[model samples]
Target chain A: MKRRAFMLSVGGAAAGMVLLPRMAFAEAGKIDWYTSSDQNILDFWTNVVKPKFEAANPGVTLNLVDAGDAAGQTAIGERALAAMQTKTDPQADYFESADWRLPAGAADAGLYVNIKEAGLSNYSRINPLAFDGDYSVPYRGSQVLLAYDTTKLDPANAPKTFADLVTWIKANPGQFIYNRPDKGGSGGNFVRRAILEANGKDLGKFKIDNYTQEAGDAALNPAWEILKDLSGSLFDNGAYTSGNTQSIQLLGQSAITMIPAWSDQAIQAINTGVLPETTGLVQLQDLALPGGFSRSVILSNGVNKDAALKLADFILTEEVQSAVLSELGGFPGVAWDYVSQDLREKYADVIPTTIPTFPGGDWEKAINDGWYRNVAPNVDRAA
Target chain B: MSLTPASDIVGKKPGRGLTGLLLVAIPVLLVCWMVIWPIISAIGRTLWLPNDGGTGRSFSVETYKFFFSDQYSLNNLYVTLWTTGVCAVLLVLICLPIALYLRFAKGRLAAYVQGLAIFPMFVPSIILSYAIIRVLGPNGTVDLLLNSVGLPHIRSPYLTPWGPVIGLVWDNIPLTVLILISGLGAVSNQSIEAARDVGAGRFAVLWHIILPRISNSILVAVSFTVLGIFSSFTLPYVLGPAAPEMMGPFMQRTFRDLNDPTNAITQAVIAFAFCIVFGLFYVRSVAKNRAR
Candidate 1:
C-alpha cells in the first residue's frame, strides 16, 4: 500500500465513525424516548402512540426504549449527566417516568429544558396537581387505591377512611395485605397513609426539601406502631407481597379479598381480565391515598432535542392523554375537563377528587428502611 | 503418564513458550478485567466513606459497622445462610437417589429419569419462579386439588423463608445430579461385582466403595450450589419473605429502593466474604483434582 493511500483510508474511516451517528440521527429524525414503565405502557406506546405520531409528523421517528426499572433509568440519567457535563452527545433524547432531579442537579444546572415555558401549544391542558416542575413534563398519572373483590365485599360497603380500612383488616384477619414499601408505591403509600393518620393527616409535616432525620423518626415511630399492631391481619399473618403485581395476583386468585394496589395496574389487570370481573377499586374518602404523575424530561445535549420536545408536547395533548386513560388504564395528565367526556364517565367510579402525594427524598428513604426495621421485623415463616 | 510440567514441555520447543503465554494471557487478563476489577472497585467504594455533612472523605469501615450492629441486617444474613444450607441438603437428598439410579439402573426408565433430572437446566429462573408460584402459591394448583378432595386449606410455603429453599433446590437439581452422576462413573461395575462376591450387601458396597470415591464430587456440587444460592436474587426476591430477606434482595432493597448505595456495597462485600469460604473449597477441590 502507498503511504498516501494508507493515510487517506485511515482519515476516511475516522471521519465516518464520527459523522455516521450524526447523519443517522439527523436524517432518520430519531428521538429515543427511554421509559421505565411496564409492558402495558410499552405496548400502548408501540401500538398506538408511535404510529399516530409518525403519521402526523413525517420524517420524525419515535423509538421507544424500555429502560427496565427505576435503577436502570437512573443509570441512563447518570450517563446523560456525564454527557452533558462533558458536552457530548447523550444518545438519549427523552426520559419518561424520570424526574428533573435525577442526576441531583441537572435541572438547576439548566441541562434540561423548562417544558412549561417552552410554549407547547397544549400547555393549557396541564393539570395543576400534575404540574410537578419546570424542567420536566408530566405525561401520565397513577395513584394507590384499595382494590377489593366485590364477590367478597360489596363495593358500597368498602372502607372509606384509613381508620375504617384498619378496622376492616382486623375484623377479617388474613384477608388483607400490601406489598413491602420498598418494592412499590402501593405499599409505600399505604405506609404513608398510616403516617398521616398518626399525625392527624397533616400533609404539612413532611417536606421534600427540608428533611431532618430526627423529625422523620419522630413522625414515623407512631406510624410504625400502628402498622405493627395491624400486622397479624395481613395475608399469612403479616407476610407481605413482594411487589404490586403479586398483591394483584393474590387478589385475582381469590386468596385475599383486599389489597392496596396501584390504580393503573389494578385497572389494567381488570380490563385485561387478569383480575376477576368482580374486582373493584375505591379511594379513601377521609384522606386521599397518595398519587404520582410520571414525568418526561428532554435533555439539552440530546442528539435530537427539538424532536424530543415535540414528542413531549404531543404526549400532553388531549388525544394522547385520553389514550392514556382508555388504552394504558392510567389517569390523564391533563385536567379532567380536557379528557374525552365518555371515557371520563366510564372511569368515573375510580376517579379521585384529590391526588395527595407524599414527599420523596430522605423522608421516603427513611420510611422504607424504618418499615423493614420496626414494623415488619418478625419474619412470617410458614407453619 | 509422565508428570513433566507444561513449562518443561514449552521449554523443549522453540517459540512455543511465547505462544503458550499469549494463549493463557488472554483469559487471565480477561478474568482480571471482568471479575477481579469490579470486585475491587466495589470494595473500595464501600470503604470510601464520606464524613458527616458530606464535607470530607476518608477510608473507613462505618458501613460494615452499621451492617454488623443493625439487627435487621443481621437477620438478613442469618436467613441467607439458613436458606443456602437447607437448599444444599435438599439438593443432595433429592438428586443423589436419581444419580445412583441413573448410574446403575439401565432401562428406559433410567433414560426418562435422566431427562427429567436435567429438564430444569433449560428453564430460565424467571419461568421457574412462575411455575413454582402456580404450583405452590396460595389458591394455586395444590390448593385447588386439595380443596377439591375436601382437604382443608394448606399453609403455603410461598412468600416465606421456605419459599426460596424450594425454588432454589428445584432450580439446582439438574446441575447437582449431573455432577453426582459424573462422579458415580468413577465407581466401576467390576468393583461392585467384586464387593458383592465378597458377600457385601448393596448398602455396604455403597458406603465403603461408592460414597468414598464420590466425596470430591459431592464437595464440588455443594460448593457450587452454595455459591449460586447465596448470590441468587430472582427466586428469593419473588418467593422469599419481605423481612429477613436473603442477601440478594436485601442488598437490592438497600441500594435501589432505600437509595443507600454505600451500605448496599457493604452488604455485598459481606455476602462475598461469606461466599469466599465456599469459593475456596471449590478452588481447593479443583487444585486437588489437578494435583492427582
Candidate 2:
C-alpha cells in the first residue's frame, strides 16, 4: 500500500509536467529566441536574425540568447525543464541545441511545437541522418580539419596524409595532443574515426550483442598501442585534451604544431587573435567524416510560422549564405554557389565539402569511438 | 504549540505556536523539494522504462544484463573489491608506524612534521596525482634520473588496479594521523608508566597497550578510507585504462555519454546497494566492538 502510494505520487509529479503554462507574458508583439552559440556567433545571430528579421515581419521579436557550448546548453536546458516542471514557461522562446542533446532534452521537455505541424513542409535537402531526424534541423557545420602552427614547421615539414601525421607524432616526442575520444566531442570523435581508419577495419559489419571482447580489443589494439607509444612522445603531460577555449588558445599561442579542429573553430581562433592568421588547415587524404551541425529549433508559442519560415529561408538564401561565408569562414551550401566560385578559388585550398566519409566505422559498432572523458589520465604511463 | 502540548499547558511556559510550526514546516518541506526530490526522481527514472527501447523507449534489465552478464564486468568487480580490501589492510599497516612515531615524538620538529604531514591534504588531489605521476611514472623525473644514471627506469605499479589503493592511502594518511594522534593522547599516562615499570618492552607496549587504546580511531579511519575507495570514480577514471577494465571507467562509459541512462542507473543502483551492504556490516562490527 505504501509502495503504491509512493508510485502514485511519482505519477502525479510526472503528469504535472503536462499542466505547465504554455503562454508567454512577454509584450504582445515580439517572439523571444534563445541559442547556445558562441558570443561572437550570438552577436551575428542577433545582428542578422533579429533586427532585419523583425523589420521584415513587423511586431515580431528575435531574442538571440547565447548559452555557450554543448556543456553550457545541457546546464541551461536542465534549468529550463525544472522551471517548466513547476508550472512555469521558459524565459526564452526558440533554442538552438546540438544533435546529441535534443533526444535527451527536447523529447522529454515537450518544449517543441512540431515543425511539421507548424507548417515547416520541407527540409528534405538536409541530411535526415541527423540524430534519426526526429527533431531539430541542421544549423551550422563544424568540420574536423588538421591544423598546424606555422612557427612549429615549414611547409615541407607540414603534415599531408594520415601516415604523415602519425610519422610526425612519433618523430616529435611529447608534443602531439588529440582530445581523448571519450572526453572531447570534435577532436575525440575524429581521433576515434582516424584510429578505425588507420587499422583498416570494417565499420558496417559490427554487431553489438555478440560483440566479442577480444575482437573489439583487437580491432582497436593497434590504435591503443600507437597511442601508448605516443603518450610520452607527443601527448600532453596533463593527459586531458585541451578545453575548447584552451585548445583555441593553444593554437593561437603556438603551444602545439598540429591539432584536429573544426574548420570554423580554427578560423574563428585566427580571426579572434587566439591563433596566428598564418596557421593553415587540411583534410586527411582518404577520410570525409560527417559534419557536426548545429540546428535552430523554433518553438511554437503561438508565433507566426510563415514569418519563421521566411527567416530560415532568408538565412539559407544565396546572398545571406555569401555573407556568412565571407565573415564566418563557413563553407557555402548550394544556395551560395555564386560566391562559392570565388571562395573555391581563394579559400578552396583549405575547406573541402566534397564527400561525407567517416573513419570507416560507426559509433554504435565501437563504444571506444565515442567522446572521451576528461577524467582518464595516462594511467598506463605509471603502469 | 497547538494547545500548549497538554503537559506544558499547566507548566511554566509554552512554545511559540505559529512561528515554531512555520520554521519546521518550511525547512523540512524545502529540503524534501530540493535535495531529496531530485535524487528520488533520478532513481525513479531509472526504474521505469518503455518496452521496445525505441527512440525514447527504455530497456531496463537490458542494461543490467549488459553489466552482470559480461565477464569483463565480473573481472572489474573483483578487481575493485580486491583493490579496496588490500588498500584498507595496507593503509593500516603503513599509517600505523608513522602514527606511532608521531604519538611519541615531541617538540618543534614534531609540530612542523605534524603540519607538513598534512600538507598533501591542503594541496588539491588532482595536483598531487600529477606530482605522483611525474615522480613515479615511466618517463617521469625519478625514472629519467634513474635512466641517466645507467640504471633501469622503474615505474610504480600504482597505475594499474593497485594504483587507486596508493592514492586512497595517500589521501587518508593525514586523516588517520590526526585521529591516531588524538587517541594516543587520550591514553592514560599512569597505565603506560605502570606497564613500563613492570618491564614491558617497547614492542610489547605497542602491541598490547597502544594498539588497543587506538583501535577505535584506526577502525574509523579504515572504514572511511574503505568507503571512499569503494565509491570513488575520479582518480581511477583519470588514472586507469579504457573499458572492459576498471570499475570507475566502466561506470562512466555505460552510464554517462552513452545516453543509456538505464545502464547508468543500474550501475548506480548496484553501487548504492553495495555501499549499503558494506556500511551495515561495518556498523554492526562497530556496535559489537562497543558492546564488548
Best by TM-score: 1
- Candidate 1 lDDT over B101-206, as tens digits, reads 9999988998999999999899999888878888899999999999999999888898889888998998999999999999999999999899999999989998
Model 2, range B1-292, lDDT digits (tens) per residue?
3342463445543343333454455456667997578667766666656666455645355656777886666767777787778878887887788777777788998788888777767876666665655565445567668879999845343235545666667777787777667778867778888999999998888888888887877777777777777767766654544432356656666654454566666776666666666677668757976898
Best by lDDT: 1
Candidate 1, which segments miss by more than 4 Å at Cα?
A1-28, A379-383, B1-11, B52-59
- Residue A128 displacement in candidate 1 (angstroms): 2.4
RMSD of each: 5.6, 9.6
In model 2, the Cα lDDT at residue B173 comes to 76
- Model 2 alpha-carbon drift over 4 Å, by segment: A1-87, A91-97, A104-142, A146-159, A163-179, A195-282, A288-383, B1-65, B120-167, B244-249, B285-292
- Candidates, DockQ: 0.31, 0.08
> Chain B alone, TM-score of each model?
0.92, 0.77
> Can you write out model 1's per-residue Cα lDDT over A227-283, one digit (the tens) per residue?
998987788988888888888888988999999988888888988999988888889
DockQ, prediction 2: 0.08
